[model samples]
Each structure stands twice: as C-alpha cells, then as structure tokens.
Target: MSRVKESIEVDVPVRTAYDQWTQFESFPQFMDGVERIEQRTDKLTHWVTKISGVKREFDAEITEQIPDAKVAWVTVAGEGEQSGLVTFQPIDPTHTQVTLMMDFDPEGMAENIGDKLGFVDRQVKGDLKRFKHFIEDRGTATGQWRGQV
Candidate 1:
C-alpha cells in the first residue's frame, strides 16, 4: 500500500469546514477524479472516479466520525483497496486547518508506475487546495450533519 497525506488552511471555522465535508456528494466540486459520491447512509458512501483514463467504482464505510474534528473510512467492496481520514483543526475563529490522509494499493502496472511517480500524492494536494477555494468562496457550508459515530 501507498500513503499520501496533505493539508490546507481554509478561511472558515472548523465547524463550517467540517459541515461542508459531511456533504460528501459535493466532493466532485473540488476533488479531482471524483466523478460522484452518493451518501448511501450516514456511514456509507459509493464513489465513482476516473483518473488518467482509468475508471473505478467503490463503496466505503465510515469507520469513525467526530463532528467538527475528524472522519475516517475504509473501502468495503470496490475496484481498489483503500482507506482514508480527514481532520479539521480550528486555527482561529475564522480559520481552519484541514488535513487528509489516504492509503491505497496499486492494482496494476500503470497504477504501480503512477504510485512510484507520486501521482496520488499530487492529486491529494491538489484536491485540498481546490477544497480550500470551494469552502472559502462559499463562506458557509452547503449543509451539515452533526451526528457522531
């Protein structure tokens, strides 16, 4: 497995950032390669992605979630093996630090080569940067889910 971690500072409170994240379907607005996300339930999500001409579909189950703090998930059934975590830290009343970490296994030769070349790392960094812009520009979360698990 390969791991990638990236973080960004957004001009939004931790609560706002965390709330926006709970709306998983909005991920395609900022997450590159994420074609769509369907929130099947509070703890389950289905994902569709296409990167570098490879398309994949997967289901991920949220393993842990703490409002305004962190969320973690692991793939249950999918075209790939992966797990991830995202955290929100309050830098101040109007600033938040969002961090994302992911672990994935390279499935084939192309993926193995891309992994060696740091493709996933770069993608995650870019995704976080876009997320910063997405949330900061909105100035408020599209929606929120305060439930804990």
Candidate 2:
C-alpha cells in the first residue's frame, strides 16, 4: 500500500473549509485528476478520475463523518483499493488547518512506478495547495452538509 499525507492552512473558518469539502461534486475544481463526483446518497459517491492519461471510476462510501471535524471514506467498489480521511482543525475564527491522508494500492505498472517515485505524494500536496487557493479565494463555502454519519 502507498500512503500519502498532506495538509494546508486556509484563511477560512473551520466550518467554511469543512462545508466546502462536503460538496464532493466541487472536487473537480481543485483536485487535479478528478473528472467528476456524483453524490449518489449522503454517504455514497461515485467518482471518475484521470491520472497520467489513465482513466478510472470508483464508488466510495463514507465510513465516518463529523461535521466541522472530519470525514473518512473507503472505496467500496472500484478499479482500485483505497481509503482516505480529511480533517479540519480550527486555528482561529478566520483560519483553518486542513489535513488529508490517503492509503491506496497501486493497480497498474504506471501507478506502481509513480507511487515508488513519490509522484503520489507530490500530487497530494499539489491538490491540497489548489484546495487552499480554491477556498481562500472564495472566502466562503459554496455549500454545506451538517448531517452526521
């Protein structure tokens, strides 16, 4: 398994950051390889992504969720095996620290090579940076989900 962890500080409140993150459909805006995310249900999501010219689809189930705190998920059915968690920590009313941790098994030669070379780590970092910009630029959440799971 390959694990990647990345974090970024955003100039937004924890609620704002967590709210924006709950809008999974907006991930394509900041996530590099994501093509689309469909919220099938409150705890289920379908994702389409393309990385390094390779495309894949997957269904992920939210394992645990705590509003303004954390969200955890695992791939239920997909072309790959993976799990991830994202957490939001309040630094101040106008500042938030967001952290993402992912564990995945490379499925193909290309993916394996990328994992071994730290490509996945760099990608996670870049994604977090983009997310920081996406949220900080807006200065507010596009939407919010407060339901617990």
TM-score of each predicted structure versus truth: 0.98, 0.98
Task: State the weakest 10-residue window (summed lDDT) of model 1.
Answer: 118-127
For every candidate structure, what is the RMSD over all alpha carbons to the true structure, in angstroms? Answer: 0.6, 0.7
Q: Write the per-residue lDDT of candidate 2 for residues 1-149, one digit (tens) a residue.
A: 88999889999999999999999999999999999999999999999999999999999999999999999999999889999999999999999999999999998788899899999999999999999999999988899999999
> How many clashes show up per model?
0, 0
Model 1 residue 91 lDDT score? 94
Worst 10 residues of 2 by lDDT: 106-115
Q: CA shift at 117, candidate 1, in angstroms?
A: 0.7
Candidate 1's TM-score reads: 0.98
Candidate 2 local lDDT, residue 70: 100
The digit string of per-residue lDDT tens for model 1 on 18-130 reads 99999999999999999999999999999999999999999999999999999999999979999999999999999999999999999999999999999998999999999
- Candidate 1, residue 83: Cα displacement in angstroms equals 0.6
**Structure candidate 1, residue pairs in collision:** none
